[model samples]
Target: MTEEIIIAGFGGQGVLSMGKILAYSGIMQDQEVSWMPSYGPEMRGGTANVTVIISDNRISSPVLKKFDTAIILNQQSMDKFESDVKPGGTLLYDPNGITSHPERKDINIFKIPGAALAAEMGNPKTFNMIVLGAFLKVKPIVAIENVKKGLEKSLPERHHKLIPLNIEAIQKGMVNVESVNSI
Candidate 1:
């Protein structure tokens, strides 16, 4: 099986990091993976996006026009990638900064309150992990153990102490995701 995913958000929202972690998790599961990131010059508050592909077989390229999943974190992303989801695919989003909601009926749409959850957890940095957890809940592609390992690998040693908190955020997201529409 192959899953093509586009994760898009404003810079500093951990969009690239989420894709990287997901790619690493896929690698830990012995799958072919590709992670390509794009962002504007202004780093923070600028548009950022990453495309990740995970497959059981060979991956020919990292570039893609459409995706099996689109994980959106902001209004700009919702506007940009909502229509790029393949028919019958999945679209997971965090309803934090969205002004217009998704309206597609062909694909599945799920929303997670990542920002609010992160704030409640008293660490807004775990917002990405929470969204990742919601995505995993909808599509159980990689193992949780691998995700833990990926988190450990992606974060620096100095930040290693926050692993448990991130895990907790993931669990919180897993249980809090709400289905907007499913097909």
Candidate 2:
């Protein structure tokens, strides 16, 4: 299977790191993967986005005009990438910073209150992982074991102690995702 995904949000919200973890997970699962990241000048609160493609066979290129899934964390990203989801694809969003909801009818929409949940868990940094967990629950592109390996590979060795907490956040996200019929 081939999945082209775009994860977009503010720069400090772990958008790039999430893509990296996803790419690493694909690699651990023996899948061909590509990750491309983009961010505005401000870097912290400014817009950031990453495109990740995973496939079972050889990938011809990394560029993509549309995506099979779009993970939106904020209203700006929702505005930008909502229409980029392919018909019959998936659109996942975190409602914390979203001012406007996705308006597409051709795709499936899922809501994960990642930021709020992360805050409730007392670890705001786990928000992205929570969103990723929700995505995996909806579309098991890669196994959770591989995702754990991915997290280990992506995080610095000094921060290894947080893996369990991250895993807990992911589990919380998987259970809390809400399927929305429409915006």
Candidate 3:
């Protein structure tokens, strides 16, 4: 199985981190993985995006023009990457500051209110985990146990205490992800 994905959002939304976690999860699952990120200096408020590819066989390159899945966190990203999703692919987004929504009928569109859900969990940092969880639910490309291990590997020991919370946030995402459009 091969999944090429692009995750985009404003900086400070954990776009790169989420991609890294997903990459690590792929590693734990013994899959070939590639992760690449791009961001401006004004990361906190600027745009940030990452490309992650996971496959059962060898990976030729990290660069890609289209993706099988897109995780969009902000309106700008939604505008930018929505068209990049391949026909019959998945476009999962967080509908927080979005003024425009995905309109493509060829790809499947899913929404996870990560920001609001994170706020409801009383910890905004878990927003990315929630989003990741929604992605897992939709794809299940990587196992949850591997994802937990991936979290352990990505986070420093000092923050290991938050893994359980992150897992909870992921579960919330799994339950809350709503199908916006599917074709």
* All-Cα superposition RMSD per candidate: 1.9, 2.1, 1.8
Q: Which candidate model has the greater lDDT, 1 or 2? A: 1
Error of 2 at 42 (Å): 10
Ranking by TM-score: 3, 1, 2
Model 2 spans with C-alpha error above 4 angstroms = 39-45
lDDT of each: 0.91, 0.90, 0.93
Candidate 2: the clashing residue pairs are none
Report the lDDT tens digits of candidate 2 across residue range 74-131: 8988887898899999999998867788877889999999999998999899999999
- Estimate the lDDT of model 3: 0.93
TM-score of each: 0.94, 0.94, 0.95
For 2-88, candidate 3 gives per-residue lDDT tens digits of: 999999997788889999999999999999999988644434658899999999999987888899999999888887789999999
Task: Name the lDDT of candidate 2.
Answer: 0.90
TM-score of 1: 0.94
In model 3, the runs with Cα more than 4 Å from the true position are 39-45
- lDDT winner, 1 or 3: 3
Ranking by lDDT: 3, 1, 2
